[model samples]
Target: MIAVALVTGTLLFSPVLATHQVEVRGTAVLSTEEVIEAAQVPLGVPLTRLPRATISERISALAPVADVRFGQSLPHTLIITVTERTMVYQVADRGSFHWVDGEGVDFHQTAEQADGLLGVLDISNERLLRDVATVVTSLGPEVVTMTTKVTADSIDHIVLTLSDGRQINWGSAEKSAEKAAVLPTLLGMKAAWIDVSVPSHPAIK
Candidate 1:
């Protein structure tokens, strides 16, 4: 009888301990404010109402939010978890800088520190964004950091600038997976630009 009474007491007390709490935790690749603003979830909504899948879907609408995970902390408390997309290039729209993700979505930054990012200019279309993102995503982390900007003349052809002022010519997005697979080997080469448009036969200019 005593043990059963204690167990019931714990369950009842558990709700009192963690009720009415909500936390939003996420990496702000574009900006935290954007994520919160875009979600537009109602304040004080119960954790149960904050459907995990629904919230994730809504959050994904934001270009910078690559992935999101949400859960309930207590009856009334909810926890939001998010993974932000990496900033591949900052497209100069007009005069201001807007961060573009692999999907080619534009986002506003909340801090001035983002100014030092690699500036990708002369892009006025959506097709170029996907093309650039394809190349940026294929390359490994080390190679991505070396990239400064990617300008696309056509969907298949793109030019990438490196930190050392070198240029890279990427042919077509068709063979992007194959082209990206060989990037690790190409990283060792020292040239003005490494062309991965043709993985079987690459031309260094």
Candidate 2:
């Protein structure tokens, strides 16, 4: 009976463990105020009873959020950690562009161009979009730094344009990992065009 009463009082009546503040971290494109408002964290509630699952669900509903985690500090604080999506490329529509992540999700739209990320021009189908995204995501920093744009008429004919006006014919998304692994070294060779369509027998001319 003593233990039960202690538990009940600590959980329900204790002011020391009550939520006094909410702290949000790991946000890049989102504002701290935005996450706090969505969480709707009840003030003065006991830390253990903060409805974390529901709060997580609400925050996850935000388009930029890829994942969210919750925790509580012993005295009087609630902690929310978020993992935002990694935007890989941009696709133009009228005057604006949609920011697409590695998973091919169009999460954000803006009129200004994103620096360092490649722009995709001719990808027409959803399947091709995902395929090209996978290929672009697999590429190393060296390759991406050199690349200016990506284009695909079909899923099987993905292409990357270099800053120096060179092309890399990345046939399909099938062997992307292998192709990416070999690209840094391949770019150093004297070649007219590079093809990693078949990574095992890559053609460079």
Candidate 3:
């Protein structure tokens, strides 16, 4: 009992286990300095006294942060691993748009258009927004590169417009992988419209 109490007291009070360095990892668009600034971890504070939950909340408030995890590296370091959000497509909102990730999280907002991502137009509510995100993000690289815009009047009426002014009737978010797999072959044809809502039997016009 005495030994355990001594060890606990030493960890809580001594500078030997205090954090002197913060190591940031797994960042893409976020800089290490910005992550450190957001963490606000007090230097020379005992690791046992660290407010991990508060630190996580602060770092997560950053627009690009999807998830954050912390670890104590013994002696003098606090390690933070950050997972940044991926901008799958842009959802239009008047003059600007919000960026959505694969799981349908709207994480960032910007007025300027981004490269290599489709712009979603005519989106109404959160449900349809998530549905559109699912359909577009499930597409293979070949189909995604050719797509310029995605629009959905209703969940069942999702459509994709290619760069060459042609259209693809994507139906719903169901069977997205199959639909994406079949689009490249269908794109070779000079059809004005291609329907892969049911990939087993496609339609063209």
Candidate 4:
């Protein structure tokens, strides 16, 4: 009876543990004010009673947030951590370019092109964009530095153009991890083209 009473007392009267401040971290593209606005954190609510999942869901609804986590600091503080999506490719539309993340989400648009970002030509299909992003992101840093552009007529017809005018027939997004693993060795050879479409039996010319 005494334990139950003590628990009830804590739940009912813990004003000192009520949330009074919110701190946001791990943000790069998003401002702390934007995250705080999106989170809609309930100030004055007891930290123990705050709906963590609900807060996370609200923050995740923001376009740039790829992932989010929530925590409570003792007494009166709420902590929010966020992981923003990275721009992997850019699609040109009517002379303007939009940034796309690895998940194929076009989250931002700009008139100026970013250095080292690959351009996606003519393809607007989201699935194809995702496939292109997958292949581009899976490549080793060395291979990525050599890549200049990615293009596709269809989902299965993905191609990568290297800085030295070499071409890579990446096939579909399937088996990308395997292809990425083997591509570096193939690039070392004196070949104008490399096809890792079928990673197990890659071809070079």
Q: State the lDDT of candidate 2 residue by residue for 63-182, as single tens digits.
A: 899999988777899999999988899888778877888988777777888775655655346687688789988998878888988887777888899989889999989989999988
How far out, in Å, is residue 192 in model 1? 3.4
> What TM-score goes with each of the models?
0.67, 0.85, 0.80, 0.84
Error of 2 at 99 (Å): 2.0
lDDT of 2 at 159: 88
Q: Residue 25 error for model 2, in Å?
A: 1.7
lDDT string, candidate 1, 1-205, tens digits: 9999998667654544343654668775545666666666665544444445765687788766777877765556566678777666676655566777777666555433364335454556777667777677777777777777676777766777778988777776677778777866776777777887778888675
Candidate 3 residue lDDT tens string, 66-87: 8999887888999999999998
Local error of candidate 4 at residue 66 (angstroms): 1.9
lDDT of each: 0.67, 0.85, 0.86, 0.86
Name the TM-score of candidate 3: 0.80
Q: What's the true lDDT of residue 125 in model 1?
A: 73
Candidate 3 whole-model C-alpha lDDT, 0 to 1 = 0.86
| Poorest lDDT segment (10 consecutive residues) of candidate 1 | 110-119
